[model samples]
Target: MFRSRTKDGQAVTKVTEAEPQQIRDPQAPKGRPTPKRSDALAQRRTLAKPPANRKEAAKRAREARRADMQRQRQALAGGDERYLPARDQGPVRRYARDFVDAKWSVAEFFLPIAVLILILSIVPSPQFKNIAFVMWIGVIATIVIDSFAMSFRLKKGLAERFPDENRRGAVFYAFMRTLQMRRMRLPKPQVARGERP
Candidate 1:
């Protein structure tokens, strides 16, 4: 405080300014403490390094991918959709799988019949080769017709059951599933033949 002159010519005292207080924020800090540099570096094993380190990193990646693939394969065989690849991951895809699995497809017999035809075509006799060629063409035509029928039915069923759901690629997905052998199908058949999907 200091003495000052007023308008009345009197000595007066004034108060000094007080220090400003820091304001506290309402936000809370992170629950964990900051990590040390060494610990952070140790966690990043795939960071760029020497040529040998790069090769080792790639090997590690392969091993991880192999393990993941095996796990997915087991999941597929067990009909567990949780670990399935993206293409097989949704209600629509599942419905398509069930629909295809419940029905026998001419496309499924395609592989075995094709192999038989291949063998027949390799025979020395011209008659067998001609027969095999005709068989192959017939089998392919049958598969094409069957695929179209299945696609139409699947599209109709999807439209009826899932009017609002995304149906894009669903017909193709079901058709491809129909082509695969039942035992070899991924996200294996949950429904038996004669069961309605």
Candidate 2:
């Protein structure tokens, strides 16, 4: 008792559903049920190993020995040789490490100078004005030197830290560090933790 409209806009009998289409390609493989997880795991395990030769075993042993020696050397070096430290340590130390690893930018180098200039200009004292002028010149000079020095430092740091020279990640890290001024906050440890220490 379904109703439908005809192409000519007159009333017509409604079709309930369309017939399923049959596959015409005889070469096509029939669908099968997916293998169970355990079955798949068993298959993988079966294909996993062929047999380790003496040379392969010796190579693995050598690699293990090299890794052990490297670890021993790192421990003797006071654990500072590693660029990234392990997690689960105190927050303060982690923050310090992260700050040191961070890169800086040109704008970051100028930020202190700009702030110093503003502070000096705002203060109303003749003697202070003379001091401010000299200080401002010093600040400008420092900014210039820091800019060049930071660039080289960042490049070297990235090369040392990453096996691959990931310039893009390094640049991004540097920009974020500059904007955050993580290193500057370190000297005043109290401020770093949002309190006076």
Candidate 3:
């Protein structure tokens, strides 16, 4: 123990002690109220509990999946850029799709014409089969020429519009999209046929 002298020159023993509990000032800003421990424990227990049964759990999972798909479909239909798939996202892709969709392409009719040719060739008549073969050749040539022209135009336009965008695979994407009928195209065409991009 150590002795200390005060102003009066009296000896006194000094004792060190911990600080007393602090009194909160009523005028001071009070932050958010502290949550109860019981409330926190209840929330944790509720989260830890499993569903009533396996069937119920499965049903909930299925419903969640359906909801997610529904949201995706809505986003796709609306062309909400954020939720679009990688292949269809970005302003450049949208521009390319619009450019392809706005014009008519000979390839759009290729499927039906090919089917027609097949039916004609199956008639078992040599003359008819020869005619069908010739028609098929013409169809192929026409589509090839038209597709080449369309692809050229699309590439040129994309280059002009989005000089900084990566052109790789974009041409093929536009070409494939151009092959489908305008009405049947997915992410449904934003512009009508003949509409400018």
Global fold similarity of model 1 (TM-score): 0.66
Ranking by TM-score: 3, 1, 2
TM-scores of the candidates in the order shown: 0.66, 0.32, 0.67
Flag regions of model 1 displaced more than 4 Å.
Answer: 1-67
Better of 1 and 3 by lDDT: 1
Residue 140, model 2: lDDT of 64
Q: Judged by lDDT relative to the true structure, which candidate is superior, 2 or 3?
A: 3
Model 2 misplacement above 4 A: 1-116, 163-165, 172-176, 183-197
User: What TM-score number comes out for model 3?
Assistant: 0.67
Kindly list the per-residue Cα lDDT of model 3 for residues 10-92, writing each as its tens digit: 99986555644579998887744667999889767756987899997898688778877786777667667776778888888
lDDT tens digits, residue span 109-190, model 1: 8899999999999999999999999998999999999999999999999999999999899999998887788898888799
lDDT at position 77, candidate 3: 79
lDDT of 1: 0.87
- How many clashes show up in model 3? 0
lDDT of 1 at 32: 55
